[model samples]
Target: MATGSRTLWKGAITFGLVHIPVGLHTAASEQGVDFDWLDKRSMDPVGYKRINKRTGKEIDKDNIVKGVEYEDGKYVVISPDEIEAVFPKTTQTISIERFIGANELPFVFLERPYYVAPINKSDRVYALLRETLASTGKIGLAKVVIATKQHLAALVPSGPALVLSLLRWGDEVKTLDALELPPAGRGNVSAAELKMARQLVEEMSGPWDPADFKDEFRIQVMKLVEKKAKAGEGQTVLQPEEDAPAHTGEVIDLTALLQRSLKGGGKPARKTPAKKAGAKEPASKPATQKKAA
Candidate 1:
């Protein structure tokens, strides 16, 4: 249950009269090769420029204004002051609205996940909350404001840690009615076919090991890069200045918390299996790889 070095947001988890101070750390990282735009001749980095779309001329930054479209070829201009006034207030609290069964949440609504770690001597209360959720098989439906935007999030107990998973708003998800999908519940399928399908699934099903998957595209691209670098064909690109690190508050002793939770009959975290050596590519390229290419 090691947390990330940097905390993106410092907040408190609140439900009823309980308050547990916590910090949100990014749980995921973007995976892929990042290609930067550069001037071919000078090898200088190229950046975006604001331009007047209709006039075909570059525009000064001061001339830009925010607006929303009301109708065709019409817009309602909004000033910076107005936008700031309407922005959601940063309450610095993950306010739990209600609790729902673990299975009740749909996978489609899940957007991003962050590790919620206890901070400022709130480990006991955090552990209590995590254990309660785990024992009851429930997840807290909460709203949290981060970077001035309010997000619908699920407070889920993940082994020794609590995960704050951001969810898309109800209206953000489109209805499936427009698609011509087959009717639900065994429509036009034979008993023998169903039996075979079940058998295949049972045979293939095993423990969920994340190491089983690998980003083949990234690996291949990195291999190509290494080959070119070894041949002295690499260019020296200037590195951009890094942003100041976010304030990481007091670190919690997760090991002790986990031990206490497990002593209360909580299950231990699952161990990830070692990745296979010399993994071979699939016989055919996967659909994802094809799309990426």
Candidate 2:
């Protein structure tokens, strides 16, 4: 696919021996209708007005400066120059601090994603970092300042390119322990239950594949939108049924459990030697007949 020339954040990835200059480009985008608030009588598009909550009056942009309330009912205004003074001058480095396993970080910590590409003709260095991370099964954790605030990000090998996922800081994430919950409190899981879960898991194993999944809701919504546009009338489409997925009990063996589950559950699988052709033969066998004298 052809890539856009928009650079979200221009920076460099730093490590022990690697200081690869790269630019961060957004890897994804939101696609949908853009709605505007308008004056119904005149059909004039409305622009938002900044209003004071206490006074219930519109405030001018010049009067609405950035401020943080240090005390009750009072805020000290800060200027643009004050904000600019803290901004980082260099927009050419990612500055990797350390490398750690990707799974070590919680999913809640990940906030945003950006594609990292080498600067000018530094493709060689970019490829080196991508390959190194891929081989070692590790992700690079780095701190880079973009705009005014600094961000914590994880550098990961994403297909032919590198992706940097912006992460929430230590103070940003509140631990679940604050809820005063007991150990493994919510889910009523036990040893046998865990074993059954494992059995079900082994039964439904499959290779990692991203192409198999997609945003079905998005596709359907777009289709409805296109139909309305052509018809010149808005119409709602019926939502599809949410079927409960059948989960098999966790089998004892991860490998064999998958094969048997596929056989029993009537799901077609690969024709490997381990995955037999007639997995349901044992279950389908008829009872023995009595012999007549």
Candidate 3:
């Protein structure tokens, strides 16, 4: 579970006669290793330079101006003062428009999530709202202006805290009809195929465990980095097993594949590659073993 961090935005939830003061805290963070660019010859850090595309000349910050391209290759430069003049008024309030069933909104509409906490001794009111939403299985549809742009968001209760998830505008979501997909039940799904597929799904179903999911690629990459740093340059590092070759231009037997997968503990075993000629294989230890000094 994520704990509350520094407050990002402060506001009040308002709809009808009800009002609850709250503060929004960031709920998630980006994960993965960040690599910096470097000059290979000098082994020095490399920095990005702003360059004019046509002239291939470096540009300075003062040389740039904000503009909107209303016509092809034609832009109207707008100043910071002009933009701030027309900015949406920051009411610092989440004006909820209506309440709907919690499940009514599609998952696709939800975007960034933030943890909502009571501010300025409004704990009791916050608890009331959270309990009411949890008991009734309802969520609040609200609009808020944050950082300049206005956004539609869903306010719902999760455990002890209220969560406000930013939503995409209706126009932002593409229509499903645009894709030329086959209609439901229009594809050639035989009775036996359907039955087997259902059985496979049922057999594989289990309780949701988020802890079981992990970024194995990131883990392995970091491990490789550690090994290389210890081994220094000009050393060969052992590799992990690669995935089997994908079938190409051949007819696939979906039913047979499902049956075999189900029988073989629901997952296929990976094939280890053969060593190259005259390459002596080292004794295998855990992948995270420290390189010898």
Top candidate (TM-score): 1
- Order of candidates by lDDT, top first? 1, 3, 2
Cα lDDT of model 1 by residue, 159-233, tens digit:
998888988777666555443457999989899877976786677788999999999999999999999999999
| The best candidate in terms of lDDT | 1
| Number of residue pairs clashing in candidate 3, backbone atoms closer than 3 angstroms, sequence gap of 3 or more or interchain | 0
- Model 3 local distance difference test score: 0.56
Q: lDDT by residue for model 3 over 149-178, one digit each (tens)?
A: 677888888898788788877666544543
Candidate 2, residues 1-293: lDDT per residue as tens digits? 22344667878975434466777654334332233333333323334565554455555554555554455544455566985786564333455656678779888778878766444344554565678788888887766555434777787888897887888776666544323345765377778866866776677688999888999999999999889889889656999997643322212233454456456555222222212111111111111110000
For every candidate in turn, the CA RMSD to the true structure comes to 18.9, 26.0, 27.0
Clashing pairs in 1: none
Clashing pairs in 3: none
The runs of at least 3 residues in candidate 2 whose Cα sits more than 4 Å from the true structure, single-residue gaps closed, are: 1-64, 88-90, 146-149, 180-190, 232-293
